[model samples]
Target chain A: MEKAQEIIFAGFGGQGILSMGQTLAYSAMIENKEVSWMPSYGPEMRGGTANCIVIVSKSKISSPIVSKFDSAIVLNQPSLDKFEHAVKPGGLIIYEESSIITPPKRTDIECIGIPAMKEAQKLDKKQVANMIILGAFLKKRPIVKIENILSALKKVLPERHHHLIPLNEQALEVGRKFVQ
Target chain B: MGDNESKNEPRLMKGNEALAEAAIRAGIHAYFGYPITPQSEILEYFTLEMPKRGGVVLQAESELAAINMVYGAAGAGARVMTSSSSPGISLMQEGISYIAAAELPCLIVNINRGGPGLGTIQPSQSDYWQAVKGGGHGDYHLIVLAPSSVQEMADFVFEAFRLAEKYQNPAFILADGALGQMMEKVVLPEEGSLPYTVHNWATSGMGKRKQRNIITSLHMEPEKMEEVNLHLQKKYKEIQKEVRFESILTEDADILLVAYGLGARICQKVVELGREKDIKIGLLRPITLYPFPKTEIAKLASRVQHTIVVEMNAGQMVEDVALAINGKCPVSSVGRMGGMISSPEEVLHYVETMILKHFVSA
Candidate 1:
């Protein structure tokens, strides 16, 4: 496995992109790894597009800002178009085929079009599309254990949101199965 | 010192532990501070630890009350101190002026945060003018120490108290959020250094003093007020000679970066990156914003072609740098307002494009 990886999540405002980045970063920190999660949204957080960068590494990261990303996950068409060329060559690009109509234009990168939203709808939770994407990310780059990710989600999410945890886990399982 | 030198001295500790340790070492007995900030730790440390070592830590209701408490404590000739952040310090200005007017000895610490309003819980160095120009109403000056590192933060608390006693005036430690949050290795002071005596003028409960000593600033006569102001002005002039500090990498450089508090640390990285790129850049980190380090900066002005002042605010400290250099060096300012920190890369880019490129062309 790589010693350091930079992952970016880009999507529409309501797509839980920031939460997904935070969960991944928190999971890495739980495993005693250095991680930095910075979200990008000002007025964009209200209704416009939103994105976040999560860097998980063994050594301390020099700069939190990234000029190029190791992995890019797009949940919307605009996000896909915006970040396609920015993904590093031979890196992975996971796009939700149900929401993002156009695929990435980068030929050198591995593009995996997972129908994450469709899979979440099957689980009767449209909001868990982010979880599905997260599960795919974990399968692609298993830097942290599945148990750690679940525990991290439980710790971060409020008690009222706990009931939805198992369903989100199911969505992740569906994503992992599809990707495998 | 020998016992403390051996086996890591048994000292009670807290977030405010550094201040108490420094206070005891500086021989301070009377502590008058209201709880605020990152500074609540200091108050808690004193409350629990001060009594064990035969000291007084009074938690006042408000910052105004706290500063007034210090004034009273100092009046009684006890080594006195108080602390608060920007908003709380604003409330203490009236009492601070009284202490200044009376020429009493006391130390104050301001752990700064983002402001102009009730800002978020993040670090900022936006209180440059408020601190240097005497935040309280008066024709008075304060001995302001701007500490950039954690070790300096702990050490300056003691230094501020010492300077206060030495000059018979108020001293301030202007610290920001980063220093408060950052954990660094700190050596505890020895135990026997706790109790130090104050001057004969301090009212120790009126025991064997000529009549009862009156600590008042209510001399309504114009001549007396003028005389008081003149005496303060003379003392301030003397303090200018005692204004001591440190500057890193400012000699024979093309671009000079002027920053204080947390911003200075980031500027250090910026200077290092510029040096790697073969750009002659240095930093003038103001350890004391007041006394403004004008002479040191004026000397650097002859050598450095340009200077850039980076701060967490819009443009507070840059004005001081521009004034200090007397326009000999073209000074520009870059900052991020509203609880955001200016990134090192952002500052480096500004230095390269604004200062370095311009100087090279000239």
Candidate 2:
């Protein structure tokens, strides 16, 4: 196990970027690993470029803000434009391809583009794009187990949205297959 | 969020939400606050959680009204609290001073943002002077506690409320926006005993009691006001005696780093980074700001050749650190003002190039 894995999830506000980071952080918490999740806050987060940093570590995390990322999950073109350079030399950049016309051209970092919006539409739930990215993120990083993510989704999702659990599980599986 | 869930398991919680949950577990009676960036979650969490626990949560029209409501509730002997960011906290200073002078116990949380004015929404420790040096126009000191982690965010509310009740003075949780906004694993305290029962000192409607209770700070006579001021000073001294701090890796280190709240969290990592490079640096984290950990800092100053004070403000707490050392050792400061946050790497850069270059070995 690595000492720490710092991930940045970035996209527009309504793309569930914050929740994706939250679910990942919660999954890390379920594994009893120390985690810190910090979302881009303030009024600008409503419709602007929203990003969150999630650090999962074995030891206590010192700072929640990281200038460099071990991995980046970008949902839009701007996110890719902004965070593509932020990924470490050998780090991974998992992006949603449907919204990102210009894929990352960086040769140093590993880039995996999952057609998340297309997959979410295939699942008949456009809102599950974030979950698709989550699955792809796990496939790329495997920092936490898939079961941990499932349990984490149950915890992060509200009771009113519990009915969507099976759909979300399917979305996760679809995303995992996309990455594979 | 419930008490009946898995008790031992760690829950990921935001710093602001944790404060609300802890207050509920602490049996707080009422919460009054206004909507403010970075800290609106505190008031929102209380709105949802407090009403479930048969507590009152109100969103006042402004910070002034909210703090006055806190003063009213505390005056009537209810365990009440109010939270706001920098600008909003500045508005509440007058009410806070009255609460202190009237000797009403209450909890106040300042999830500080960048300031001097409505500076920025980002995290900053510029409120250090306002928090410790008395923001309001009075000779008063708040029992200020600086929480670094989400768990501390929750845990310190209980302690803050306890201290406020024990001293009959308002206790301030001086948390920065980073601490207020960040999420971390927190082992919340169990639903246990409260620090003090509200009915103990609260001035409720007297039915059986023969005498009427009044809570007011207006001392028109100079003699009476002087007596009140003298008593407050005595309480401040007692609190100073009980000041809490954490001296990390300072036993044999040559250079000491003094910081609190978010600054301390960042410097802790700097110390780790420094140790990796064989630079022997220590960190002194002051948990209590008002009762500024002067004793330990003074001692560390005597032992160490240099002390570098780090904060998000433009050298506010640096004054206190320099005062504590009192020229025993060279005390310098590195700060990020105007709502801009300096990363750990940046601080380490300053330490390596500037701080280490200027402050030579004894």
Give the interface RMSD of each candidate. 9.6, 1.3
> Which digits, one per residue and each the tens of the lDDT, describe model 1 over residues B317-353?
8887888899787888899876678877788888777
| Alpha-carbon deviation at B296 in model 2, angstroms | 0.7
Clashing pairs in 1: B16-B42, B76-B203, B77-B202
At residue B133, candidate 2 shows an lDDT of 88
Candidate 2 vs. truth: CA RMSD?
A: 2.0
Best by lDDT: 2
Candidate 1, residues A1-180, lDDT tens digits: the string is 355798889989988887788778767766877675655533465457988777788865434446468999898888888888888788999989888666776789889888887888888889898888888878987878878888778755777898888887787787787676
**lDDT per residue as tens, model 2, A1-180:** 556998999999889999999999999898889999988786655568888999999988987877789999998899899999989899999999888889999999999999889989988999998888888888877889988888888888888998998898888888888775
| Candidate 1 residue A117 C-alpha distance from true site, Å | 25
Q: Estimate each model's TM-score.
A: 0.67, 0.95
> Model 2 TM-score?
0.95
